[model samples]
Target: MAQSWQRSYADMKVRDLEFMVGERVLLKVSPMNGVMRFGKKGKLSPRYIGSFEIVKSIGEVLYQLALPSGLSCVHPVFHISILKKYHQGGAHVIQWDSMLLDQKLTFEEVTILDRPIQNSRSKDIASVKV
Candidate 1:
């Protein structure tokens, strides 16, 4: 039957990832249609953010994580489908402390180079360094 064939095709692509307590994982987030995320927009936006520690497993497919204070507004529990098991890596380490976020989750621009300002517009341009 068509339904049986469809199910078989879907099963081939499904991932069976398991998670244990005290393990670190990355949370998956979908980017908005027109909004920017992590300095990238559209397809360029990051698929996952933050490396949170799993505090507890609620059920077979749900988990609770130890999220940072900045993400307190979000719920602690999440479905396993939205979590990706994190592997230790050098490039994966991010300096989150230096990132400044506003209520809308947009990053604040930081000046990269110092310049002697002669006009008020120069200050505004400095903010656009990034």
Candidate 2:
């Protein structure tokens, strides 16, 4: 049927991510609807929060992560759509203890160590040097 073909077409783009016990995975940070609105520069903000270890796969599309003690209030299980396998050599490892994440999994403003203001086209643009 047309609906079956449509489902297959959609499924083609989706990867069946499988995680085993003790494997590490990154938890995607989806923006909260009410409190913090993702502004104009859409892709500027960070996407994933962890490199957190996967405790186990609860179901075909659900995973349990080994979250830190600081995130005791947060739920452990997450859908596969919001999870990505953590490659050992993929990117920089985050210090989970130092990061401040709210209940909505939104991170606080990153500290700007050095910011230089540059004037361009009658506008002052502040460049952050992290």
Candidate 3:
């Protein structure tokens, strides 16, 4: 009776997430709470970032993902604990071709809305609107 009660208690709290092949999911970035990594500042970093496709289910709790070229150095297989099911929504769509990013991941300003002007005191107020 005690064993059955324990099993029921565990089932009430533990969730089993089974991800299908070709489904998109987010990868968790496990970082030290106060450390900075991957260009994300300390305490303000994103806990999970991705919409990577699941290539296959390696096992019941493991999966292989089709990561983008940017993450080629990372291992493709990940434990289910670090994966989050991604829900597709219109707001989550990205227009990759429409982005104007260059080699350094910076986009050039197409036009300047306003130009800087010097005040009467000869101080140049450099304010830019892009």
- Cα deviation in Å at residue 14, candidate 1? 1.3
Best-performing candidate as measured by lDDT = 2
- Per-residue CA lDDT of model 2 for 23-107, tens digit only, reads 8888776644433412213556556667898888887988889898998767888998888778778665455567666677766
> Across residues 1-130, which tens digit of lDDT does each residue of candidate 1 receive?
9999999999999998889999999876532356566666677655666688999999899999997887766678888887887888826545455665555445534445645434574454323334
lDDT of prediction 2: 0.74
Stronger candidate by TM-score (1 vs 2): 2
Model 3 worst lDDT window (10 residues):
99-108
TM-score of 2: 0.68
State the lDDT of candidate 3 residue by residue for 8-111, as single tens digits: 99999988899999999877665235444334465554456667799999879999999666656567889998888888772543332343333323223346
- Residue pairs clashing in model 2 are none
Question: Mind sharing the TM-score for model 3?
Answer: 0.55
Q: In model 1, which regions exceed 4 Å deviation?
A: 31-35, 93-96, 100-130
lDDT per model, in order?
Answer: 0.71, 0.74, 0.68
